[model samples]
Target: MSTYVIGDIQGCRDALLRLLERCRFDPAADRLICAGDLVARGPDSLGTLRFVHGLGTAATAVLGNHDLHLLALAQGFGRARDGLDTVVAADDAETLLEWLSTRPLALHHAATDTLIVHAGVAPQWTVAQTLALAGEAQAVFADRERRRAFLPRMYGDAPARWRDDLTGDDRLRCIVNVLTRARYCSAQGDFEFAEKGSPGAQAGDLMPWFEVPERRSAGTRIVFGHWSTLGRIHWPQANVWGLDTGCVWGGALSALRLEDLHLLEVPCAG
Candidate 1:
């Protein structure tokens, strides 16, 4: 059975369906790992969430920034953005949001030696450390009382550089930023939130997280999606694959086969 890693669906259910059909995905055998941003800003957030949620064990997802935003909205911490109201108003909204909250910030596919995250890992973190750190944030979501407090504190970009000594919300927020919102980072590994452009678009000394020299996680293959502006990059030299192709922005929905690096895509209806 093949394992397919899809980029941001962003509520474009039709495009996702077409892309899956093209891949000939079988729920019984094939596995689907989504790089995240499953719902938001497109035609059908509710339908998209239902389809992925229906996949059950056959599918797994990493939590993207949009996903977190949705979670926060669900908990009454943030304002509902356009296109997201459908999901919030759905009958199964609680169920769907709960499933999303349970998703990890990092997912490791052992057979492929690929670490899947919604955005990028901290340059200083190794594959093992990335997962461990992600777990810390995941634990917060799992705790009822903690989740209520945590979701509201989830919206900042303070403490741009990660430090071992950081405690409480600061630490978790940094981890979430690196895993979901990061694109470019300073040479010394500080997150550069404002530079969301493609590789060359950033200013001096700033580079894509995966391209950071001597990044500890560089040894393992990484599949990430947050930067749709850097669309469909397969930099084997860096062992990084960027699958987001701006499908929510009227581009194509894209996916990569874990075993062979073959690409499958379908133009978005949006």
Candidate 2:
């Protein structure tokens, strides 16, 4: 009953299948946790969604920035690119999207004591706080009425720093950004969304969210995707594991076993 945490995937269903086979995944025994961006930019977004959705109770996924983009496009808020159009036009699009919307932005796996998110947690937030904040945003995405209003207006980078006093859409957006789009941020929790390069590539005081001094979420292991440019799965001394090995960009589709940190990858080269 091993649990494997897979990376972005980004709609590469064939690569995902091969990677799962490499791990010898069994729906009857093993559990799969997807680090998000399950669709977009690959050859089979619709098929990938259906495959994961079909996994039923065996699979769990959090929403990535790309996942939210697809959600917004389905509701006339944004335009599609890559393979998302197929998902939007599918007969079962509504059902698939509904399941996606129900997914939380932050999830805690009790067996591994690992927090799984698309990106990283806010430097100032404790593990419990991260899950609580994620619940707030989850409520909005879960309610159809609020979903209609929020999806269209969800894109933004303002109020880059998080404050406990934040309210309304601003609060929801902040939580979403931290759990989904975050990469580089100041120690004070000010996100630097533009820096997607590896650690040394950034200028100024911004550092990788997990590397921030005295990060409240430290000590507990964090597994995340969304930063393929990061160049490796394990950092020298960090407790976080970066699993996005650029699967959609012609790199390997990667996965890590939670119990032993056993790693494996299957090259797809896009």
Candidate 3:
């Protein structure tokens, strides 16, 4: 059975199907992992959710920033019209949201020695620490009462540096931002949440999260999306594969066949 890691679907069901076809994916014998941002900025958010969710145990998804936004919207937290209304208004909205909410922020594939996250990790964190901290934050998101209380307080870019002494909302927020929205970050473990650009475009000491010198997680293979401009099939230094090709932005939807590191993509109408 082959495992395929796909980039952000962002509601592009047709693109996703075509890409899957290109990979010759068979739900009965293949596994799928989504790099997240499963909804928003594209058509058919509801349809895409059903398609992936219908895959059942054959598919796994991490929570992306947009995915979290959909959860917050479900709790009557925000009023942003970011193309997710179809999902919120669906009859199965609650069920779909429940499934999405409980997914991990970071997952490790022991067979591949690959770490899967929506975005990237804090430079100071090792593979074990990334998973542990992700679990700490995941606990809050997976529980109903804690999620209701934390959703509104979740929109922040504070305390970029990860400290062991950090606690409460601050600690969870740091973990979420790093896992779901981080890109350029300092070697000191500080993140530039505001900068959404390609590597050469960012200024100052900020570098791509994986490129940070002596990044503890650097030794393990990391599969991530969220940086569409980074494009398909490129490993930052050698151990990471960035698959987002901006399917929601009129680019191709890409996926990596993890067993052999083969890349496949399908152009999207956007």
lDDT of 3 by residue, 69-180 (tens): 9999999998867678778889999999999999999999888899999999888899999999999988999999999999999998998888989999999999999999
Q: Note the Cα lDDT for every prediction shown.
A: 0.90, 0.91, 0.90
Q: Can you give the lDDT of residue 74 in candidate 2?
A: 90
Kindly give the number of clashing pairs for every candidate.
0, 0, 0
Best by lDDT: 2
Candidates in descending lDDT order: 2, 1, 3
Per-residue lDDT value at 234 in model 1: 90
**Candidate 1 lowest-lDDT run of ten:** 228-237
Candidate 1, residues 1-270, lDDT tens digits: the string is 999999999988899999999999999999999998998898888899999999999998999999888888878888889588778888998899889989999999999899999999888899999999999999898676888899999888988998989999999999999999999898899988988887887898998888888999988999999898994479877899999999989888999999988999999972
Segments in model 1 whose C-alpha atoms lie over 4 Å from true places: none
Model 1 vs. true fold: TM: 0.97
Cα misplacement distance, residue 151 of candidate 2 (Å): 1.2
The Cα error of candidate 3 at residue 260, in Å, is 0.7
Sequence-dependent TM-score of model 2: 0.98
lDDT computed for candidate 1: 0.90
lDDT of 2 by residue, 1-270 (tens): 999999999999999999999999999999999999999998999999999999999998999999999989998888879878899999999999999999989889898899999998998899999999999998898888999899867888977988999998888888898889999998788998889998898989989998998988897899999999997789747799999999888899999999898998999752
